[model samples]
Target: MTISANLALAYPEIILAVGALALLVLGAFMPKQTSLVATGGVAVLLAAAVASATQPFGVAFGGGLIADAAATFAKVAIYVASAVAIPLGQPWFERRGVKTFEFPVLILLSALGMGMMASSGDLISLYVGVELSSLALYVLAAMHRDNAKASEAGLKYFVLGALSSGLLLYGASLVYGFAGSTLYADIAKAAGAEANTGLLFGLIFVICGLAFKVSAAPFHMWTPDVYEGAPTPVVAFFAAAPKLAAMMLFARVLADGFTDAVAQWQQVLVALALISVAVGAFGGLVQKNLKRLWAYSSIANIGYAVLGLASGTSEGVQAMLVFMILYMVDVTGFFACLAALSRQGKAMETIDDMAGLVKERRGLALAMTVFSLSALGLPPFSGFWAKYVVFKAAIDAGLWGPAVIGLVGSVVAAFYYLRLIKVMWFDGSAGATDKPPMEAKAIGLTAAVFAFPVVLVAITWLNPLAARAAQALGLA
Candidate 1:
C-alpha cells in the first residue's frame, strides 16, 4: 500500500511525532516556562493516547506498521505513564533549579518512539523505533547535567545502548538475508520452511538485544547504575513506560516473526526468566539505594512477565499483559510515594532516608505499605493477581520447573520488600527528626489515588481490560 493510503492507520504515532516536534520548537522559544511545556506535553500525550484508542486498526506504511489491539493498548499505557511522570517530576525539577521546557519535550518524543516500536511490523521500523526511544532516554538520563552521576549514567546507557542496537541491526540483516524479506510475515514463512542455522543465530542475537533493553539477567549490568544515577522522576518513568513498550514489541516480534521457532526462543526466555529472578531476588539484599533496589525488583518482575511469553501461546500473551498492567500501576504509585519523601528539601536516595517515615507521615507510610505488599505479590493485591495469571499460564503450558523457580524467587524477594516495610513502620535511626515535609503532597495524593485501582483491580475492572487485550491478539 502507498504511504498516504496507510497514513490513517498510523495517525496516533504521526500525531505524537508531529506534536513532539512542535513542542520542541515551542520549548526552544519559551525555555523558562516549564509549567507551560509540561502542560502541553501532558495534553499531547493524552490526545495521542485517545487517538491510539480510537483510530482504526490495520497494516500501514506497506506493512511496516500495525495499529492492532495490542499495540493500541500498549500505547495508551505508555502515554498515561509518561503523563503521570511529568507532574511527578516537576516538583523535584523545580527544587533542583533544573526544571526546563525541554524535559517534557523529550518525554513526548520518547513516548512517540515507544508507540512506534509497539506498532512496528518490519525489522527496519523496529530498529528505527529502538534508536528513537533510546536516544531520547539517554538524553533524559543526563538531564541533570551538573550532577556527575547523572552524566555517568547517561554515558553508560548510551554506550551499552549503542552496542545493543548494533547487535539488533546485525541480527536483522542476517534474518533478512535468510528470510529474503524484512517483513514479519515473510520471516515467519521463511522460518517455517526449514530449520536454518543462520535464522537461529539471528534470533538469538535479536533476543539478546531485546533482553538488554528489558534488563533481563546477564544483560542487566546497566540497570542499577542508570536507575541510581538518573533523577528520581526519570527513574520512575524508566521503571514503567518504556518497559511496557519494549515487552510489547518483544512479544509481538516473537509471536509474529518467529512463531515457527518457538521451541528455541521459548528455551531462551526460560533461561532468562530463571536467571533474572535469581539476580533480582538476591541482588537487592545488599543495596542501600532505594532506586537501585527497585531496579533489581524491576528485573525480577520482567522475569515473571516473560514467563507468559515463554509459553508461546495467546493465553500467555494475555497473562503477560496483565502482569505489565499491574506492574505499571504499582511501580508508578510506589515511585511516586518514594519521590514524595525528602530530607532537608532534597530527595531521599537511600532506604535509611525513609527512617521514621511511619511516624512522620501516616498517609505516605500506608501507601508505601500497600505498594510494597503488592510488589511482594501478597494476597488480595493487584500484583498477586498478575502473578497468578502468569504462573497459571506457565503451568498450563506445562512449564512446571519455571513456575516453581519463579515462586521460590518470589519468596526470596519478599524478604527485602518486607524488610523495607518493617523499617518504614517499626525501625528508627538517629537522623529521624521532625523536618518540614517536602513538596510531595500532590505526588503522595496522586500515588494514593492510583493505588486504589491497583488494590481493587482483580475484583473490579482489570480482567475486562486484559480480555480486551487478549481479544486484540485474537487469543480470546
Candidate 2:
C-alpha cells in the first residue's frame, strides 16, 4: 500500500494521538481550561469513531497493523466508552476540589493505544499498544494523589503491569526467533506448517501476559484493589473499554496468528476460563466492598468471554464479541450508579452503604436494580442473552464440560448480585445520599433502558454485526 493509503487506514488513531497532544498543550498554556479540554477530548473521540466507521478495510504499515471489520467494531466501542468517561471525571473531580486537564488527555492517549491494540497485525505493534495504554492507566489509577489507597493502587498496578510487559516482550522475542518474523501472518504460516515446542512455549508466555491484562485468575490480584481505590469514573472506564480492547487483541492474536495450533491454545484458555470462573464466583461471596465485589464480577464475566474464545470457532468469537459489548454496558452503568451516590460528602464504598437506596433515590436504585439483574443474566435483560449466546457457542463447538461449569459458576455468582439488590430495596435507610450528578444519572438510566427494552432492538443489529466482525478473524 502507498504511504497515504496506510495513513488513511490509521486515521482514527492519528486523530486520537494528535488530539491528545493538542489538548495537553492547550491545558498547559491556558489556565483553568479543564472543562474545555474535557469537551475537546470527547469531540476528538467522537471524530475518531466516525473515522473508524468510515475507514476501508486493508492491511497497513507493512502488515504491522490492520483495518478490518473487527478492528473497526472494537475501535468505535473504545472511542465511545472513552468519550463517556471524560464527562464522568469532570463532575467527580470538581466535587473534590481538584481540577486538572490531564485526566481527559490521559484517557485520550489510552484510547489511542487501545485503538492500536485492536488493529495490531504484529507482535511489535501489540507490545507498543499495550505499553501506551498501561502507562496512562498507571498514572490514572493514582490521579487522586491525596488518597493513600489510590497511590497504593497505582503502585501495585505499575509493578505487576511491568512484570507482565516483561513476560510479553520475552515471549515476543522467542516467537520472532522461532517464526523468523513478527507479523501475525508469518507466524500463522509457520505454525500451520509445523507447530514446534519453542513456538508453543512462546505462545503460552504471551497468553499469560495477555491474561493479566484481562484480569483473569491467578493474575487477578491487582483488580479488586485498583477498582476499590481508583476514582469511580476511572474504574468505570477501566471496566468497560480496556477489557474489550484487550479481548479483541487476544482474539486476533490467537485466531489470526495461531489458528493452526488451536488444539494447543484451546487447552490453555480452558484452564484459565475455569479457574477464573471459580475464583470470581466463590471469591466475591465474601466481599463487603461494593467495588471489590464488582471487581470479581468483572473477573467472572471475562471468564465467560474467554470461554467463547476457547471454543476456537467463528461462532465462538461472534458470541464473545456480543457478550463483551452487552456486559460493558451493564458494568459501566453499575459503576456510574456508584459514582453518582454519596452519603454526607463521603463516597459509598461498601455494601451496607447502599442500604435502603430505593427510599431516598428511587431512580438510582432502579437503575442499579436493572444493571444488577442484567449482570446476573436474568431473563429479558441483556446479560441473559449475552450468556445464552456464549453458552450456545460453546455447546456447538463441543465444549459441553466447560460450558456446564461456566453455567454453574453463573448460578453461584447470582448470590452477590441478589444481595446487592436486596440491600438497595429492602434494608433500612443508611441515610440519604447526596443528589447524583446529571451526567452520571443520565448515563446510568440510559444504560438501564438499553439493558432492557433497547437491547431487544439492539440485538437485531448487533448480532449480525458481531458475526461479520468474527468472520474477519478468519477462524473457520
Q: lDDT winner among the candidates?
A: 2
| Top-TM-score candidate index | 2
Clashing residue pairs in all predictions, respectively, total 0, 0
- On residues 366-462, what C-alpha lDDT tens digit does candidate 2 reach at each position? 9999999998999899999999999999999999999999999999999999999999999999996888899998999998999999999999999
* Candidate 2 residue spans exceeding 4 A from truth: none
| TM-score of each model, paired residue for residue | 0.96, 0.99
For model 1, the superposed segments whose C-alpha errors exceed 4 Å read 2-4, 429-440, 448-454, 457-460, 471-476
lDDT of 1 by residue, 1-476 (tens): 76675988888778888888888888788787788888888898999999998988789877899888889889998998899888777757777888677888889889989998899899989998988999999999999989999999999999999998888898888999999999998898988899999998998899889999999998999999999999878888998999999999898888889888888899999999999999999998888988999999999999999988898888888889889988887788777777777666667767777777888877887887877888899877777888999999999999999999999999999988988888888887425433433545556555655555535745356666665666654221
Worst 10 residues of 2 by lDDT: 89-98
TM-score of candidate 2 relative to the true fold: 0.99
RMSD list, candidates in order = 1.9, 0.7
